[model samples]
Target: MTAAQMTSTSAGDGAEVAAKGTTEKRRLEGSLGVPSIVFMVIAAAAPITVIGGNSPIAIGNGPGSGAPLGFLIAGLVMILFSVGFVTMTPYVKEAGAFFSYVATASGARMGVGTAFTALVTYYGIQIGCYGYVGWAIGDLVTAFGGPDIPWPVYSFAAIAAVAVIGYHNIDVSSKFLAVALVCEIGIVCILDVAVFINGGPEGISWHSFDVSHVTDSGFGIAILYALTGFIGFESTAVYRDEAKNPSRTIPLATYAAVLIIGVFYTISTWALVTGAGASKARSVALETVSGNANMMIDMAGQYAGVVVRDIMQVLLVTSIFACVLSFHNIISRYQFTLANKGVLPAALGVAHPKHDAPSRSSILTTVLGALLLLILVVAGLDPLGGVFGYCAAIATCGMMILMLVSSVSVFVFFRRHHEIVGNPVTTTIVPLLASLGLAACLVFILVNFTMVTGGSMAVSVILALIPFLAFAGGFVTAAASPRMRGRFMANVL
Candidate 1:
């Protein structure tokens, strides 16, 4: 990647600015070549598998056979949003991911708030995956006469394993994610092919893509839920420091990941509808899959034989683990970046001397994840419901905020910098409108979060408030810190 032009400012006395106020070295040593980039893309896209594996069943029940239309609508909206998102990457240089975009577009305080909110959201997601991994392992073990392990035990174990992987070498994690991703995509493709060949229950219907379905009440709800599955796709920019050619690679990966994920989800959701039959699809999904994690396995056994079913279950387990590893690396890197920037504690910025990895941050991330897992298990909540639902909701909110900020940033940057507008209608105006649309979506999801997740009002309220609280806490801490107080004020003014 081309190095960013370094600019320095000096005081009247000619002394250099404090290092805290300067940008840090591009210290990421790993080379995220095309293969590794693909891994990152797929890992971020893995939640789509879970969504397809689970939510389609719920959507089928709620929106009838028109559920695929929801995925299509969400995918199209994300595509439009990506146009603005990809355009802004070349203009921003921070590694705090979306938080950095917000900082550059808005101001230091808002940036800090965004960073803290993102940290909470990403960490919650990483920890949330532990519960999912544990639940999957626990179920698999129970089938084999193994001792029944509690969800927290499995979660803790997964957290420890991910920590080790995340703290050592980026290449190692990328390779592991690559293997799991191939397996996941392969299985999903196979299922789609089988569904097509067997023919749909009621044949392909144009109603599946109708605008009315897109406008349905449950359709918007399902689209919001479906959009969450694609949350991590934006992380491609997070790896800019490590990318081979960031300007080209980041934009390419960003757009490529979104399109690939959108296509995969669209095809898979359609296959699911056809496999279960249009009229009975919802009931079939609920009865056979939503409540039962093994629904895919059972379906594979019936249509594709025992071998495929067994292989799919194994791949599903690996996919979940890959997601854990991916998010662990992401959250740890965010901590490392923020710490290095003096926005967080310096201790988190330390990298392993030999490994050149953020070892300390990784360990701390795992510890936080373990604590969250323990708290949920002790509270007697369903691990999947509490961990995935809560974390996913919060992460979704954080990402939506980031997207909104990035959209406005695009318009402002172009306007202020006098950059020529290319296709202003599609690029600027449409995305600005989409930003407003997404903001409305965010508020709707937050207000009716319980309905979206099928959780109690209290649980939904708490989960929805957590991101805001994290943002507030970060702002308060930054304002009070002796180290940051001066810089914060200077940057704001």
Candidate 2:
């Protein structure tokens, strides 16, 4: 069979394909288990970055002390989404995550559309991280009395670093990410424990979860921002090609990623609220956020002393690096999957002969990200507000849409394939609920997009439309080109 025709059937088939003497068609190397997979997925979430970088805005502009409830709500929605998502993984034969699952249940046209959408989602987040990491490095340098360098210079440096790591086998990135994830989670936990021990000025309280606060006017925006922290969690399935015992690993990693991210965010946000006194949480958040500082970091400085605070400042930069590396791996694999299916250049489909990694695709992803960064520089946009803010808004919105579509696809796929024998609660009921929740998130994001992007109504509208445009572009390409149609129409499932 031709390389394009040999869709990925098993995560353990790498050696089989190699032994068959198909030197021209090496598959991605596999050996990753649950712990490794969990590390990568959680790193993509960048827990420290989310709490330190994103929590201020969420607290000030969202539900204030009630932000923890938003995390809880978003986590529950994701758990429901994962119920159907992981349940369908055993039947999918490819590592295209959203692309494979949607295609198997829906049609080639929609599958191709989803592939395009997934690309937009991952690339958006990756590029945004480049912007944030650039800003982060610049801040760290100045804090240490280093010369002032342009943020773009830092961004390029980070892109180069990620490119080097990503060109290696998945195992290398996984190990590095595991260490970074530990440090990121560690600092936050230290602060949490400190705040709990002190009991704050108001003496520890659950005021953040009060029904009145959760039902506040800003709760919708709180949920929107909270949901963004979970952006990369669903990516557990994207690494399936490199996973050992993927059917079990993917599900375990997915649940662990969701639960850890949810509980961590909830507790940390609550700690901040308690540390500041629930009544003063919003005011404290506004003071920090408005002055371009992180509320969590400030809280850490006050509760855990300058030592832990300094460590957090450094880890914040590393956290963004971890985010970039994790997303880089994901996008490269997606490109490899698309290439194997004939949607992209066939050259991108091949794994590295020595590393067994998607070297060609990784190079392309790096180039694309650099080009986007260059555009932001030439356009003279702010690394934090312009590049990070707008790009992150786009990524978060696009991911919500993908999750919604994936949820519906799960229900439809299971309903039609009675032979699969999935539990009704997980397959039908949970997915339907997940679809509604995600749809609400997408709508809320669109309606209040200016809040997320910190851009004008006009720019927010334009940025919001890009995901749909990408999906349409792919669907049209599949429908118009006879060659692409034939490739995309393959019944891999």
Candidate 3:
């Protein structure tokens, strides 16, 4: 061969190699079992936070003892939602969760839209959680005679801790969450059992599940609170690539986490009511100057005694840490996914050579977290009200919208790829049913958006508009990018 011809051939081979490298499949450490996934889900739910923060408001404002019924109702709805969600997981494989499923059915544009919605929703919620963590950790430190640092300072510290763990092996975060989960769950259970054994002034009765309270003025509010507690449950699918058995583990873990969160909240909150008396639960909750904020801590003293109460306080901080870590990992994975798909910077998708974790994305997440928390600190926003409350409200509403979209996508996906699935109910009928129920949920949440955010009508409208705008922005990006548009169109099953 001529020397010039040889040079051209060598260049052509190098280009093919580069192209193959670009398309290489990356895998995360798959040391996770069902238990690890469950811990991750429950940690994100932040059980102690809900029972302590939202439960009092639920019982005091809603139907008193009947508030536990809200959890049961929400759980049933989630189970129905899961019937379709889990059923479709086998056909697609990725940590993309709703974005992957949405794209599978609707098109790439909708997929990107879901991705943006999830990024906004999870990041918003994660930042909101750091607000609570800051206050809790700072208070705990001061109680122990530590320095009087600002809450946001403690928040930055917590973000730093998350960054440290998030950059390492996934198991490191998982094992820590498991330990945290056990401590928090154990303390809560002690309170639950003690309350059950001792009964209450009104008796440990079925009054909590009573049907008449269905028409109570705060019924919508109670359901809204119940739904918020399950915000991170769908994230079971996000750990698919890291699961020991994605098909079985993901589905079972999703179902178990939802039911466990629902039942756990239902019983714990009911115990609070029974410990205080049904008719008096609402009045007693409001009688406090703090109004339901420290109700659980107080109950731990009353039912489980002071030693347990102190332990509970300590565990509450750990619970918050576990949650922060869980979300840190989640958002990092999300960044990895978006980068892998060319939606974000490609460097965000690279795993650590030593840890096989999304180190780069995790680092980016940690930096973003620090920057966002700084904004809240500079703006002088209240950690509890402004950061935690408002962001959680908007994120919850956003998640519901994603769930509704996913439910419809399930049905559409099955219809389009009829050959891939067999059971009609699992694929189509149940998905359609879930879609209807989730639509109702979204409507109800929006109608009560002001109540959820504890803000004026204008503020509530803006909170409601955020998810829609984020989703639309993603759609426009996808439509405008011919490369992405073609990729989505060509990748259809």
Candidate 4:
């Protein structure tokens, strides 16, 4: 609860230059406080996107009325994960987040491997989001009697928009995300309240929280989907360099993001179940998925009338845009940090002189996104079914790996630094427990990977290996270059 004082190491090259009274080396400029940080972090989660898109699939495939419990459980696990995660924030000061923390606690080589995996995590999720939002935009246009535009066209346009925003300073992106976050969350909250007040067809039953429902046969699948909705909550730590009081701000923002995501998803999902009676929830969800209908839209029409439903439809697209924009900024910063360490091209390390933003890296991210979109399109893959489904599964698997490694790093780092005193429960026990929990989540995703991707087990196995392959890629890059290996060691260890 005391403010985390910035140590020399934690302050990074930016502070070093500032202390030396030189403007020769430009760094990212920012003064973001907790609220702004939370806005960006939660924006990545895309509240409306999850409730409208992921919720129906989860409800159909998983525990039916018990889907709400899945989110609640996932939230609790992440909260435990954060206990140790935030403990390391005061120490690992770079924007690399997962990779930086693991590198500091573990080793430079392992950190590089983690860095590769982190890239896969962010890129996969962002690309998947692009596919989804593009498809959403196309659908919206066609609904209004306009000619049906190809999804990739819209996807590329969205990539351009994100690239433009990301090319500016973090402050610019944060403000844009704040507006989108409020509007999206506001609309969902209005629907949630409307559903609760009307008491739905089932008279506001709490059957969704029943123990029997939660422990049902499809609980694993339910948990996996629910956990996906919390994907970007960990990005809170990635904004460390730009934050006003990173030590305290990072922890507070992280906790707030997780709590907000957890509480919001749990309530909104339960409302979905309540809007349609518990018995009918699963069937309706299945219908929504199979028939390609929007359950939230239908529910809104029923509870809040047509105008609200139409507005929800539009906000859904904006929610996805915000999600991708947040990821674009995060990935750019990761590239910036890696470039600074010589893990990537030196050009990527330079921030824009005027904007003090990762302009070069942001451009790199945009180009990668366009290329990914082209690859998916050329493969003749369906945007939602193929791109979103496959990529999201890959991302979910990769993120779980990052979280698990990060938790272990926390434990290892504390054990090695015996002189650094802290609470055993927060610093030690919770991390180990979190690792176990996250490991289980990883296993669940692998075991039921087919359910998530909705593809053949052969494809599932291939997609699931991407994260590990990316990790191996990191190791190979480090070993192949002695200079880079030395650089990694000098910077992290």
- Model 4, range 369-447, lDDT digits (tens) per residue? 8998899999999988899999999999999999999999999988888767799999899999999999999998888
Model 1 C-alpha lDDT versus the unseen true structure? 0.70
Candidate with more favorable, higher lDDT: 2 or 4:
4
Question: What's the lDDT for candidate 3?
Answer: 0.82
Q: Each prediction's TM-score against the native?
A: 0.89, 0.95, 0.93, 0.95
* Model 4, position 389: C-alpha lDDT score: 91
Candidate 2: residue pairs that collide: none
Question: Which stretches of model 2 miss by more than 4 angstroms?
Answer: 1-22, 489-491
Which of the predicted structures, 1 or 3, would earn the higher lDDT when compared with the native? 3
lDDT of 2: 0.86
lDDT score, candidate 3, position 1: 22
- Per residue, candidate 1 scores C-alpha lDDT tens digits across 56-145 of 544544575677777777787788788877776666654456766666556666667777888877877776677778888787778668
What is candidate 1's CA lDDT for residue 123? 77
- Candidates 3 and 4 compared by TM-score, better number: 4
Write candidate 3's Cα lDDT for 277-392 as tens digits: 88788876665315434778888898889999889888888888888898888889988877767688867767787888989999999998888878877988888888888888
RMSD of each predicted structure: 4.1, 3.3, 6.3, 2.7
